[model samples]
Target: MIIEELRDLIERHVRPDMSTPVEGVMIARDEVSTLEASMSGTVMALVAQGRKRLALGDRVYEYGPGQYLVSSLDLPVTGQFLDAGPDRPALGFGMLLDPAAIAELLLQGGAAAMPDGRGTPPSGIMVSEAPVQLLDAVLRLLRLFDRPRDLAMLAPLIKREILWWLIVGEQGATVRQLGLAGSNLSRIAQAVRWIREHYAKTFHVEDVADICGMSPSAFYRNFQAATAMSPIQFQKQMRLQEARLLLAASPNDVAGVGYRVGYDSPSQFSREYRRQFGTSPSQDALQLRGGELSLAAGLA
Candidate 1:
């Protein structure tokens, strides 16, 4: 009953017309959306109705109403809604978590409440029930849209409160690490940032390790723990996903696209691309251009 009410309220305020360029209002709708393989940011997603599934590396995660999911670091992922229909669709709200904000909040709150010991990597993903208090806070935050002036004045305060709640709540320990400087999660986050910024360039594990302030062995172990993929595997994902986007946006030379994404040997690129995407780059691009491929199936 609560979930149904929440769905109605969300659908009322966060309609398609309210979409934003950066951060859109969250809502529930009945549509079979395509699965996207892209870099996921640190986000908090709560499901008020229906269900959703996401695949990260080899790990798969699913959650439904009253449950929430968290991604503490960026990673390539395949995500789709499993339960959305005209009668009862998947309803959810997601807030992007900013590490700088979280760090500042931790400093303001003092060191007393911060967890002790080094931060470890979570399994790249985690899910838990959304406590009533957290849900209540979320509802109140959404209501702030009606008070446009107050949104500018009090939205930051409320957003900080929500982050604080996440820092101290169950799995709060993992979220808290996002703010720490030298933790494993922080290091992996550094690597993730670098990968996102320079996805078009070719880089080695040692270089990424140096960027993260970890030795190759330690970085590889920790990165795998956090992302469930080796550093090379991660880069391959970025390259392929970006190539897909480039192909979809325009008719470009397949070999040129591969070169742009940092593949030196076009033959090697074609081989790996085919292995990952199940088609040669040219064929894939043609299929996408012809609208013969559904994103969900292509991603699968």
Candidate 2:
């Protein structure tokens, strides 16, 4: 019943406008055809009327109405909306997480007790059942869209409330570490940010590990634990993903696209690209041009 009510409210409020800050837009009417992965920004997503599936490395997750997904670090992720219909297309809201908001909430809620025993590393991403209060808070936030005048005055309060709920809710520990200054997860997240910003530039693992404040061995272990991919593998994914975008953008040289993304040898680039994407860049680009590539692979 709550889900149904929430669904209706979402359908009404989540308009097709793409002008919202933090990529908060309603994607209800169209069926997404591609399975694409982007540099996973830290964010929160709640589906009020549909199910969505996401793949991170070898692990996959699905969440539907009454559930929420949080990404604490930026990593590569393959995502698609899995279930929605014309009667009720997928209705959802996403807010890119602001680390400052997390930190501010931690400072405000400090009673000096670690309520969630959140001392260890947490998965980079997590999903948990939505608490009623949290869901209600979000409903009020969406209602603000109906009154643009009120949004300026009331939106911050509601946004803070959402962050607070996440800090104290079932997955609080994970959210908590997200803001902790020197937590392991946060450190690794720093390295992740560096890689995303400079994926096309060559960098040594030692330098990255140092930046994350971990020894090389420790950094590698934790990075793999969190992402299930080696640092090189993660960087490779970023490069290949970028290359695919470039290929799709125009009739460019495949070898040039590879080299532009830091690949030194065209032969090596073609081999790796084929291995990761299951088709040669030349062939995939051809399929993409002919409209024969599946929506999922096209997204990749």
Candidate 3:
């Protein structure tokens, strides 16, 4: 079976850090993991063994063997390994999705066309069953490790093949829009980028809408649909995540970290921090330093 072959290849080639010879590929092997925040970018995560759950805003997604997850935009997400153990660890492969590569394939135009949505909006994240062809392409990509001579020439080609499969799969609409120049997804992505860059500063919706080339109302609707959160909520997530990173490095300067991240009142900052992370900022820092919490908790 393709799943069995993929499991074997991943287990053999995957190092403890999940790095591989392939440039944009990584393998994950975890015996156990807790729900932790991490930044998920444009990538496809295919699980060959065990199960995992991911939370984006209020939405929760769970997948297991023969399944895959696609995050079309960069966002803060909480992930947990649901079923893993020392004897049977959670194993998965992550392949970064390149919009440029997808654009090139779109120009060539030989594969299945994307389904029409008739103005329906698409979300940034999706989960679906991994098709046999996709699994086969992943297997071939991993197999390149066995032939160092063929890797340089073949890796990019296989990577494109894998993306092509995704472009025609159930989540094609989301993947397809990533390459379109003025797509709704692209516009929302622009707004998302602006918010991330200027998260600490307060901005009005009209200004952000102008940046995205949309009216206030339309931008709000589409942005909420794409990201599962309002623009202000998105900014809050970014701010909180950045504060967590700052606290990780300067564990003792809780008030300074909060103020630096735009929190004016120390009490308010502590209150919101506890709400977002389920613990006080000071305590979270201690746990992080003691190695009890995942470093990913600081990522956005």
lDDT of 2 by residue, 1-300 (tens): 666766676666544552343233232333453565576567777777667788888888888888988887877888777765576577666666777788888888882676432244667778889999988887777767778888888888888898898889888877887878777878888888788779989889999999887889988988887777788888988898888888886535888898889899999999998887788989988877776543331111
Assess each prediction's global lDDT (C-alpha) against the native: 0.75, 0.74, 0.84
Which portions of model 2 miss their true places by more than 4 Å?
15-30, 85-87, 115-120, 287-300
- Report clash pairs, candidate 3: none
lDDT of 1 by residue, 118-213 (tens): 745777678888887778777777767667777767667777777888887887777878887767898888898798779878788899999888
The candidate that wins on lDDT is 3
What TM-score, over all chains together, does every model reach?
Answer: 0.87, 0.87, 0.95
Could you report the Cα RMSD, in angstroms, for every candidate shown? 3.3, 3.2, 2.1
* lDDT (Cα, 0-100) at 238 in candidate 3: 88
Q: What is the lDDT of candidate 2?
A: 0.74
- In model 3, what lDDT does residue 194 have? 95
Compare candidates 1 and 2 on TM-score and give the better one.
Answer: 2
Q: Model 3 over residues 45-143: C-alpha lDDT tens digits?
A: 999998888888899989899899888888878888887899998889998888788878876874336543334358788899998899999999998
Q: Which ten residues in a row have the lowest lDDT in candidate 1?
A: 17-26
Question: Distance from true position, residue 295, model 2, in Å?
Answer: 9.7
Residue 231 of model 1 has an lDDT of 83
